[model samples]
Target: MERNIYMNTITVSEFSEDQNLIFNRVKKTGIPVIIMDKGTRLAEIHPPSLPEKQSRKFGCMKDRLKIVGDIISPASDEKDWEVLKY
Candidate 1:
């Protein structure tokens, strides 16, 4: 059985002889290059994927947190530590 993939096809000899050219083409075009040997598929050279942009939202968890008890004064029967006396 034979397959005809008519994209960017290059033989092993061509790839070995002109690796830099093929690499540059793949990098610039972001298209994969198919490597073939004796008319059989061998390997593919694909361009590196671009990193995704991350979106950050400030106060996204606002009002999600609950205040259980007093924040300013210490808990009942809890004496102030000496380290806190500044």
Candidate 2:
């Protein structure tokens, strides 16, 4: 009665017949169409993906981040911390 084919699939013949419409949908929706044949996945059709963002460089926030107090000194008195009662 029922088949096990994917819900988001398009047969090779259908893809061939309506390639223009399918490609237009792929371009507009950005969702890939899985080409199938007898429940076997054949190929995918969709627009090329774009990079999310450029890789960040080291020290790119060198001057952006603010620094305070002495660099080598402790932040607070050692006696103030109960965990350091060694």
Candidate 3:
């Protein structure tokens, strides 16, 4: 499913007073707000997701098996790892 996670840009000055408005919006709708300060990006505020996605697939069982298989597969012998020892 395509989830709607919106990000909006607002000047830092405008965000100083309307911070509550931004927090309320994120809390209510789970959207994000990017605050810009003097033309440079400042900060981002948003509701946290229920669970963070796994960043390293090797940490999982299926991924570990797939990675191990790839490493031991006959095709893996075509490449040499000694050259990468440095």
Best by lDDT: 1
Instruction: List the lowest-lDDT window of 10 residues for candidate 2.
Output: 1-10
Ten-residue segment with the worst summed lDDT in candidate 3? Answer: 1-10
What tens-digit string does per-residue lDDT give for candidate 1 at 1-86?
11222258878877887788788878888889899999899999999988998765997778899988789886644455666666
Deviation from native of the Cα of residue 11 in model 2, angstroms: 0.6
Ranking by lDDT: 1, 2, 3
What stretches of model 1 exceed 4 Å from their correct place? 1-7, 52-86
Q: Which stretches of candidate 2 lie over 4 Å from their true place?
A: 1-7, 51-86
For candidate 1, the 10 contiguous residues with the lowest summed lDDT are 1-10
Best by TM-score: 1
Colliding residue pairs in candidate 3:
none
lDDT of 3 by residue, 11-80 (tens): 7667776667678878898767787878888888878778977576565666444344355455645456
**Residue-level lDDT tens digits of model 2 in 1-86:** 01312235878878777778778777878778898888899998877788799767987788797777697876789897788997
lDDT of every predicted structure (CA atoms): 0.77, 0.74, 0.67
Say which prediction, candidate 1 or candidate 2, comes out ahead on lDDT.
1
Better of 2 and 3 by TM-score: 2
